[model samples]
Target: MKTETQTTGEQKGFYKLSSLQRIGFGSGDLAQNLIYQTVSMYLLIFYTNVFGISATAAGIMFLVVRVIDVIWDPIVGAFVDKKNPKMGKYRSYLILGGIPLTGFAILCFWNGFSGSLLYAYITYVGLSMIYTLINVPYGALNASLTRDTDEVTKLTSTRMFMANMGGLAVGYGVPILVQYLSPNGKINSPESAQAWFITMTLYAIAGLLLLVFCYTQTKERVVMDVKETENVKVSDLWTAFKHNGPLRILAFFFITAFAMMAIGNAAGSYYMIYNVQAPEMLPYFMALGSLPAFIFMPLVPAIKRAIGKKQLFYVFLTIAILGMIMLYIISVIPALRSQVWLVLVAQFIKSTGIIVATGYMWALVPEVISYGEHATGKRISGIVNALTGIFYKAGMALGGVVPGLVLAYVGFDKDNTITQSAFAEQGILWLVVVIPAILLLVAMFIISKYELDDAVIDKINHEIESRHKN
Candidate 1:
């Protein structure tokens, strides 16, 4: 009689998951985005104007903290792979890491530190590291679910849709809530620190609750055999990176895609507050950034199937580029700058492309996992996710670094309350348009190198399952 690992295998790679299962799984991303998006979009502005930190200091802190992630991600990945905990290898962290992450996330915005940079560092670093603890394993969990490429695509669609819901909440809700909570009705006002704290507290708790919901819903299936598992080392990440071709392409794409999103997201508040001169309309303006995802994401699987993967990326990326260009022209032209309606239209166009392109990238993760397992008999999901996590964070680092550096370079004075100079406004425009557009161009080229189509990944999955049976 053969053992479960070697033969008589009941667990197959492709399992058709139900809609409820898909939605539950997708909620995890939503939970993350709710809190994380707030940080990405507003944290810098919060640091400078509200929390009384300089843009340069915030920039350096962002870079240094992510450098910590560079060191920390591998350790967490290796540890997670080596031990199979009670709740589940991946899902358990949803509770374990998430609780502290919630505490730190709430604390990061508290201003109780009273402008203490040390407190800022401690809380932000804690939040990021704990986030990685959950993020790396959570990413690997997707591959362990099913090998159906279409199902993965659909799952990614649902995931992106839910993630955007979080974005919508942050993008639209945060500023509105902050303004409502603040005594003077100004969100970024230094005296309104309590307002920021209160707003984030509500968002943070909601995120943790959603994480629990995700924990209850997800179940991992197509994982490696227990007997096959071994001691995962830091070097395994390097090995995965060196050997996996699809991983190489996807990692680079993540870098560029996230940089574009980060730079654009970081600039949204600045653009609305300074460049647009309609602080009241900031909510509407920011909301447009994620609003397009809801309408376009549900159609991704159909779109990918209809036009094919590469073409879908090509078309969407081009649309994003066009939207960026349109935005730039509108900003530079004095008459068009005053036209908020025109700016919003261009924002919708750009965001539509960005949402689809970035949202669909999650589906590629499982494909790369299949390719790696096909090439090397070891299904090292943790290592692969750690590698991707590193690159995407690097991309996010670029987003953080660029805006702060730009603000510093342009001599953005947090003291100036009324309006910024022409040069400052121009710098802000570059953040939203020129910088992100250039990143999107790189993203398109990087994705073009991804050769694993759905049929190819499906074949790889089948071969791997057959080998398990034998």
Candidate 2:
């Protein structure tokens, strides 16, 4: 139970977290990815293929859920900032919201109400809304931990690494678990519905345990004072966005980055199952989406040091685009289409770039929050996170909406299980490679507008703390 003051005698607003504290805080992201990653990467496919729904129907549903999130996130953010719960300010939601989040996450994968759009909407909406209760607060928790730029970097690195571990578990392990649990060995069939439910239940319960662990391991060290928090309102979100230049830039980047990742992720199983004509390779392909994080996330601190943050982003984003181009070329070339090793290699390269670029963007969130505090007297961490959440979910909506609509336009038949038409395969290929690469290019440009380098943020954090002292 070593507190920040006891562990590090650093100045106010610059406390350094211990390794355990960092990991404990990070486990929350890991916990979230376990549930949400499964939803993001697999839920659409489960609905269209196994849950007995049209891809277009599922896509429309996804858009509607995000619309709900746009309204809900701001309210949650304002409520969290205004109220000081007895359990903990930000961390308390880790348990309170975590419980229902777990339940809804499990229910989203259940087949009891098979083909019922009403049931799907209720469960998915419940999952998305409850998720905000945890997410907005959890995001604010990062800024509350400490304002030290290096510590935030280390913390973000740990969080991304653990987050990817959760992604890897879902990407690689979900199929394996579903296969084992299924009466038959296939994952994409209606017969595997029971297995999907069982697998999600296990992952969701594990996620809940991790959230509890996160609640215990962390404390809010730096946050808005009570008086400052009292007058917080939803309109402040609009005010913050209007004034916070860096936040606006970062918010746009989140949308593009997440949309790219989401589109690619949503299309991955289809690419492997249909385009690549290798259903057996689905786990391996999806696993590659996250595996690169393990290899490269640890190096982010050093990489950022060697090359500036913007430079790092540009380099990785270009690399991701190149990897996508490679994937496209391989898919088009009759001779290379069957080269599994080449495809995996291309996936690795693409994921490497994506993992680094997107992973580091989170470090920027605290920077923007700090920037907002320096400009305005109040530190509205929840409002800022809620704003970012709105954008992030917007990107997720595109991830859901674009893929399904494209598949439908290309005449993707859920009943056809074995193969889709060439037009449909091309559509899947575009979602997997072309569309995401285009978004990455836009991400690179959007991130270029970001002005808060490490030195600037460190100065802002110092000034904010000085005001508190005065």
Candidate 3:
């Protein structure tokens, strides 16, 4: 029933990468997340508090831009598959997209266009599209690096560890930078718009520099030859999706994971100010979210070796859920709301599970790409990344939309920064605990459907390579 190319197991050495190579590759994500996490964590506050937009309007902009990504991602994927630039097939986009991404990312925070919905629409939409141009190709490059299953695992671990390094910087650093830049030392102060602009400009330039570093450090190995490239098409996206089981499972899981992160993160500022009643401790609270990645990500390959991948998911997802329950309990108990120590403890427990679970998921992208190639005789990594990108953006869009709508519905007053109504406080609580907990439960079920264990994936990758040799 199986073709020869669909069933072999050895990758040869073509995909092997050096330590320096892996670190360079990982830096690209580090660079991107520094900018991406900053926007995810602070952009909403900046929109309402500094950029002079209503929450409802900002939420609408988030949804509209993502809808565009749903279409734009496939086009980029198809284009990448069909063409190879002199710089590199995928790496070229890093410069092409990264340059504009830096510009527009800075523009998105500028208040010169304050109150202009049209300006917000253009800047945010441009940022998202260019981001895709960089992200989709970067994702495909992961699969192109090597077909060795274990190599990808190591590569992904290093990548995520570095990605979280960026997360830590943004989590702790943005508030610090903004506060220092603000004359009144309040990031949320309406007069701090100028400060927000200055802060983003510094961050955007750093992201560009990192992107350049990523460009210099890595090279692609396993890729489609001319024959395979000639056959690529936009229609190949649906064709791959319709037939690929692993891609579908990963795509759905991304939707849940990203949405969970987005909602919880967007609620973070409100959560500390309103629920924890410790607005002064906000930077510490946010930084704790990325702290566990340092502790657990380095142990990912060992953990996988010990418990197996599916069991690892089961363990961490359960831990994250328990941590959320603990947080909700701590917040609800009147005596404990001000207990910053207990809140930090709960946050540590929650982030430990979340970092390991979501952090390792990138390693699986190559597996799914190999599966699609084994089935279809085409290594359309670009199209596969595009499909996943669409779902991930959908999740992010919800992250944006849900928070804005929730805040609006609960009567979160933009003018009153010091305190919110009891009901508004509860809405933020739900974002922090209730919503992500439910989504993680769904993610647990979805991941259960992912049947490509390491052994099966290795066979598929080997088989595809065997076919290539013949």
* Strongest candidate by TM-score: 2
What are the candidates' C-alpha RMSDs? Answer: 2.3, 1.8, 3.0
Candidate 1 residues lying further than 4 Å off, grouped into runs, are 1-11
* lDDT values for all models: 0.87, 0.92, 0.88
Question: lDDT tens string, model 2, 206-232?
Answer: 999999999999999887777778789
Candidate no. 3 TM-score: 0.97
lDDT of 1 at 283: 89
Candidate 3: where is the Cα deviation over 4 Å? 1-14
Candidate 2, poorest ten consecutive residues by summed lDDT: 1-10
**Clash counts for all predictions:** 0, 0, 1
- Which residue pairs show collisions in model 2? none
